[model samples]
Target chain A: MAEPSWSNALEALADNKFVLGDQLVDVGISAPELASALAAVAMAQGELGHARHLYHWSHELQGISKEIRAESGKALSVLRHHENWIELMVSLLAVNVAARVLLERLRQLNEAMVVSKTAKMLVEMAEHITFAGEWCRRFRAETGAIPGLFQAALSRQSDAICAWLRAVDAEIGGGSDMDMANAFVREMEMVCGPVTVRHPA
Target chain B: MSTSVEYRAYAVFARSQRGGPLYQIGFVEAFSDALAKTYANLTYDEENWFELCVVPLDELRWVIEPQGVSAKGESGRGGAIVEQRAGSAG
Candidate 1:
């Protein structure tokens, strides 16, 4: 197979298409798990691209060196070597952030979709909402807006609420609704400190 | 505005104070290390207990995470705890 261009890899991941066997063989990955591995790598690559874009924006905003400025646009360079864990992790964080932002855009696009209609659905959606806010504020800060610590704290709390949602999703399949709700409340306390989750009458 | 090569001071930490975590704290936009250091120190000193560090823009650790604040005191509970405890301890 021909060498994978950056664009092809990103498009594949975004579309959720499995990487072909030829590509996997070229990379020396086994045949059976090639699809999963390819998906992971493609997703990782896409994430790096998004991170690179954000990092470049921040660098431009902050007036860093031209050399540094250039590197910000090439997040894929950070992941060239599997051993580059720091850059890889950074790239992953950026992707996680982009996922969140996309989720929010989806929600805003369809305002009628209230989360609380189903506990499981709500938790899943809430994670996306909270994560989006966190990434946006960080993006702003990195780009020189200088958000206060309190604002950052608000982002963290939003994450906590998202965590509570995940727990509810897990419990929806089997546990009693009341117990699931109670567990979610407990998780919320762990993430954001103590808080009440009173339901409307 | 100037394109001078400079370091961005950061206060790196894990999400839950765990042994192994990503570099959550991000870049400082100041020009000089001293200015960056000062900014990092003033801002992160209390939160990460002043474990401030510096890196160039190219070297910055960029593991950003989403977080939120709660009045219940989970996120930045330090400010509340320290102020309350300081009076009693002193």
Candidate 2:
């Protein structure tokens, strides 16, 4: 059988092929294409080799310079996450700390309810407080404030949460029956009032 | 590869000077939520003495730009801020 033609082999393969200069490079089958690709690979390899040598020498020089070493260390911290290093870590930590505060508030609320003997009638209230704190913390950490509860109760998810928080706040405020909720809110306000104001949502 | 990247989101908190409500100041973006918190501290830890909190992106019901709106209504310096997205706006 005759040798397969370049066109036939090229058609059989999935890769694309093109020619450069006087070379009939066949990316899929022709020698010219292979040659060009090989040349490209060689050129890239040479560039990488040069880069590696430069990097080694620069690193050695940096090792000798205390300032450069310190600067590089600082640079590593600064550029770890594409220069958004501080931004990302700090915001999340803020949210986490806030969440902890909220949880502490809930724990106190639960204690208040149990002490007031209102746990049976107001279990949902306690649950709501806990859920809101958790949800707020998670949401803040994940998407920031723009789309979170600050932005109109993201779908029904936010509505449900707001409703729950409002209801709890109301119960804590003592609508009809005199419950421990009132005292709870007052105390929370006393403790978290300064910090809570910072939250936009 | 030079793939284009941009700040997608931010974490911000507000500080209340007097006995007033706290407002959002600025934000920082990162690959994850945890990183955003770290950024929040650096940005707001000084100057205003902010009490920062992690507000979920979705739960943030209100957004007021201090620069865009004048904080000079009946509510005084804290009142003129505009709510960009009062999530619970009925």
Candidate 3:
């Protein structure tokens, strides 16, 4: 049996995906191209599917029958709506990637179901990340759009993400907050381009 | 004013088994190679293809054209051969 913290974290993560999925479904219509719009809708469906997949795992493994509800009022601040595609892309990376990282930490338990189910979920998650990352980088590359939006989005979400990490990391045996932050930075630099992650001195 | 999306067509191919010839399952139009892939995956998701790929319509060099091959899916008599198939199919 898994710990309560793990179960609760699973529930929370599932809800987070739900929120991101909901937001994406709304913004997906505004995508610049038909292909991106389709991808957005597909990705939204994928997010909702992932949430259900996790909830199923929790129900089966931990017997937590919590509903997969995504009330935006309680969502992570970083996962909120944005006016531009750049910020949307950032939020996608911020939340979706964070969810994957958290799952990685949870998968450390090495439960048979956890490993197999999350492994499948992880593959799809990586593709979503790649899609968001590529577009985010593209937004940065194109001129006549706002500058520093990526940096701003990353900075704005730092505190909430850090707090969330601290709250859940110890229970799941994940690493320090800096480790999570660095992981995000490393991914940003990799997926986008050179990026400066502003954190505490 | 409506935002205009500039894009190019990509021919999507997939194979059902290893060592088999790839079949032209469909085509998708997108602004970039990456986005084209997402479109391809979503559009051609009916099967568990063993392999899949997308090629820019401009990049393919034709040594010869197949009979009944239309450059357009509907407009050209060989419909869907439009280079990304184009024009009226007769």
Give the best candidate by DockQ.
Answer: 3
Score residue A62 of candidate 2 by CA lDDT.
Answer: 38
Per-prediction TM-score to the true structure, in the order listed = 0.20, 0.21, 0.79
- In candidate 1, stretches whose alpha carbon ends up further than 4 angstroms from where it belongs are A1-32, A68-201, B1-90
Query: Candidate 3 versus the native: TM-score?
Result: 0.79
Enumerate the candidates' DockQ scores in order: 0.01, 0.02, 0.30
lDDT tens digits, residue span B1-90, model 2 = 012322336647766565667777775554335435544544455665536655545456557734435645763554423443353464
Q: What docking grade does candidate 3 earn? A: acceptable
Task: Name the best candidate (by TM-score).
Answer: 3
| Span of ten consecutive residues with least summed lDDT in model 3 chain A | A66-75
lDDT by residue (A109-158, candidate 1, tens digit) is 34342222123423432432232233333333442333333234333333
lDDT of 1 by residue, B9-82 (tens): 44434243545445557545544444344344434444544234656555645597334332335545346556
Which of the two, 1 or 3, has more TM-score? Answer: 3
Worst 10 residues of 2 chain B by lDDT: B1-10
Residue B76 in model 1: lDDT: 58
What tens-digit string does per-residue lDDT give for candidate 3 at B1-90?
Answer: 123445789999999999989899999987678878877887788999999999999899879856566344542455445544234543
- Comparing only chain B with the true structure, the TM-scores of all models are 0.38, 0.44, 0.67
